[model samples]
Target: MKINLRKSLICINQQKLIAIFLVFMFLGFTLAKPEFASSYSINNILCTMALYGIASLGMTLVILTGGTDLSAGSVMALSGVIGAGLLGKAFSAANPVSLPFAATVLIALIFSGLIGYLNGIVITKLKIAPFVATLAMMSIARGLVYVVADSVVQGVSGSPITFMNDGYSLLGQGKIGAVPVQFIVYVILFLIVFVFLKYTRTGRSIYTVGGNIDTAKLAGIKTNKIIVLTYTVSSILVGISGLILVGRLSSASTVAAKGYELDFITAVALGGTSVAGGRGSVIGTLLGTAFLAVLNNGLDIVNVKSFYQYLIKGLILVFAVCADLFMNKRVKKS
Candidate 1:
């Protein structure tokens, strides 16, 4: 009982320390500009975090397999274009376009998932570098976006929902009392992925395959299949992020989600996922995502130039890597 009590106290202390640090950090920014800390402003920041967080969760899994995805942003663009095209006629209609919206999202998700599976196949069976393979896929996916959105937004509301704020309010624009719909969605995805990875056999296989392909294979794991499945799952998450972005914007362009892959990768790395692969935590990635989001949000509130934001983000990523290296060296020495 005494040991358990001491353990509980240590856990509580850690939680409080982290909470205090984060709270004060945000508070510092808010203090710089009181209005920036307003409820609505905070909500908007969190809303954007939702979209990126979901995408990062998927990317985190992929990186865990000693592989990285450069095609994530392109996948998001392609999915958005596909969904927008399908909503062409129904976009601006007075009635709810949930049917087409649902179908478009479904198709987009399935399409990306297929592409991910292909990535796995090409890398594992064809003996291609995951980086080179994903890079090629990125270019191809981005090109497809241009092809699909050639003409561009005609006159559609591009608005997927109309009933809640004409389908623009809740889930996208509508808040649950005070919370944003996207925020809730992101939380659900985070929890689900976190649990699935921590508790499931298939999910655990990812770490195994990533740790050592030969060892995993000898242990009777279908390494190739696992690799393919990981990519597919990651792609599906990108599709979901795309749909949310479109829903929020009420429009989609060929250029949407450009450079998102960098942000996704950076978030993963900041969360302690080794770029070389096979070491990361979903929770860490989530915290990393939040840290980035909060940084941007806080800076924006303080009126920092966008240019500065870019510079700062790059610096933070470097710092995270350095810290990771230092920790690794210390552990080795010990």
Candidate 2:
């Protein structure tokens, strides 16, 4: 009983530490820029968090399964361009097809899921490393984005596809009272995932697979299936993010969401998810996403240079990774 109680306390303390760090970060930023604590700025941070938080949730699942999806950014761009092109508006491109918003979104998500399925198949059936398989898919997906854009977009080969649809725009711009719709959606997703990971059999299998694939196989868990499922879910979530991004900007560029995978991975890592896999929670991810959102917004509010921001973010990622490795080593020693 004492051991169990101690374990619970440790878990609580870990979460508390993250919360305390966030408080300090908020206070520090507000001190640097008084306007940082304004309602508008706070709302802006939540909106940004929602946009990236959805994708980061997916990344959390993938990392928990001992895998990574380098193709996420490309998938986001591809999904956005595909969905926007289907809208068939006479903005930047003159698409001929005007499907219903729901249909367009479904088709784009299906395509992204297919890409993820392929990535999973390559990693599992072909016995390729997750990194190599996803790296290839990243290139392939980005190429497809360019191909899709060139085929639909009217102007230059690399032009952005722009459109305006009220129904579609609501996903990004709609607000209830003072809260952004996207942020609400993000919270809903976080709750659903948190419950799923904590309560579902398949979710439990994912952790087992990540913890030890050989042991999982011995225990009759279909490791490959879990990996594939994670990849598929990750891609679908990224597709949703892509659609939201397109709605937010009213444009789909070939370069949309470039390098976003790094941000997603960073958030997951900062949330204390193991890079080697098996242990983490959606709650931590939510806090990590909020931290990033606040950090970026605060830096912008303070008029920090882009280069410094990049450097600072990079250092934070490095520290998080090192801390993770250190903890893992200590656990093994114990």
Candidate 3:
């Protein structure tokens, strides 16, 4: 009875500790800068988080299945530019065609999903390690962005430049009452992914495949399908992120959102998700994102230089992975 009571106490304490950490972060920032907690600031950071969070959702899926995607940032740029092109005539300062906004969004999402599908084909059919495959895809994607842009498409308002700023701005910036649209989109996305992972057989198979593909196959799981799906999902989410990024910047640059794959992976790993796969959570990813958002927003509020942000961001990723590995070992021992 004493042993049982002690174990229960330990578990409860652990839960409380995690909760406290999250609360501290929110409150810490709120106190540090009162404006930090304001609706506008909160919404702005959340809006950005939601976009990256979408990409991270796909990345989290891929990582859980024990794979990596280095091309995500590049894919985002490629697909974002495509979405911009689709809105070619929207940039006119004089007048613009509204062209059903929903249609524009759907088109961008499908373009992103299609890119993911191609990634799936390469990894599953070519039998290449995800790292190598995604790396090659990254280069190819980046090159495509340049080729497509050709130094600038010049279509939106006579230049394919201001698509996000002028065209589908609603997706990222438009507000529903007091709340930004991104918050609603992210909440819906989060619920869907959380339910899928918790309740679906195929979702369970992702863990199995990642944990041990050979064993998963012996147990009748289609490992290749799972792997393909993983990359495809990552592609689609990253694509969504690209669209948001383009919107936020109000323009798609071949240089837009370059080098963000590491940021997504870091956010996942920091959320206490495993770098090795077969283990992770949506909650964890969300927490990781919040942490990053707070850090970035805080730094900006305090007037930190953008260059410092780059360095600090890298350190944070490294530390998060280290923390994950350390925590995993502790859990195993317990």
Which candidate number would show the highest lDDT if scored against the true structure?
2
Give every collision pair in model 2.
none
Off by over 4 Å in 3: 1-19, 90-103, 151-160, 164-167, 307-311, 318-334
**For residues 1-334, what per-residue lDDT tens digits would candidate 1 score against the true structure?**
9977865554423123333445776888877888767887888788878889989999999999999889999998788777766554433333233344567678878988987888889899998999999999999988877766653333432222212123322445657778888888889999998988889998888888888888999999999999999999999998888877877776666778888988998878777767766667788777777777888888887888999988877876676567556645654575
- TM-scores of the candidates in the order shown: 0.85, 0.93, 0.86
Ranking by lDDT: 2, 1, 3
RMSD of each: 4.8, 2.4, 3.8
- Compose the digit string of candidate 2's lDDT tens values, residues 1-334: 9977865554433334556668998999999889999999999999899989999999999999999989999999999999988888738566678888898899999999999889888999998999989999999999999999988887788789888888668988888889988888888888888888889999899899889999999999999998998899889988989998998888899999989998898888788887799988888888889888988999899999999998988886676556546655654575
lDDT of each: 0.76, 0.87, 0.75
Indicate whether candidate 2 or candidate 3 has the larger lDDT: 2
lDDT of 3 by residue, 1-334 (tens): 9988866565433223344555786787778778878887888788878977888888889899888888899889888767765554435322332344456567766766776777778878888888888888889888878765653454432244565344457776778888777767887888888888878998889888878888999999988888887777778778878877777777777777778998898778778777788887877888777777778887787677999988877876675556545655665589
- The collision pairs in model 1 are 161-167, 162-166, 162-167, 163-166, 163-167, 164-167, 169-173, 169-174, 170-174
- In candidate 2, where is summed lDDT lowest over 10 consecutive residues? 8-17
Against the hidden true structure, what lDDT does model 3 obtain?
Answer: 0.75
**How many residue pairs clash in model 1?**
9
The superposed Cα distance between candidate 2 and the true structure at residue 46, in angstroms, equals 0.8
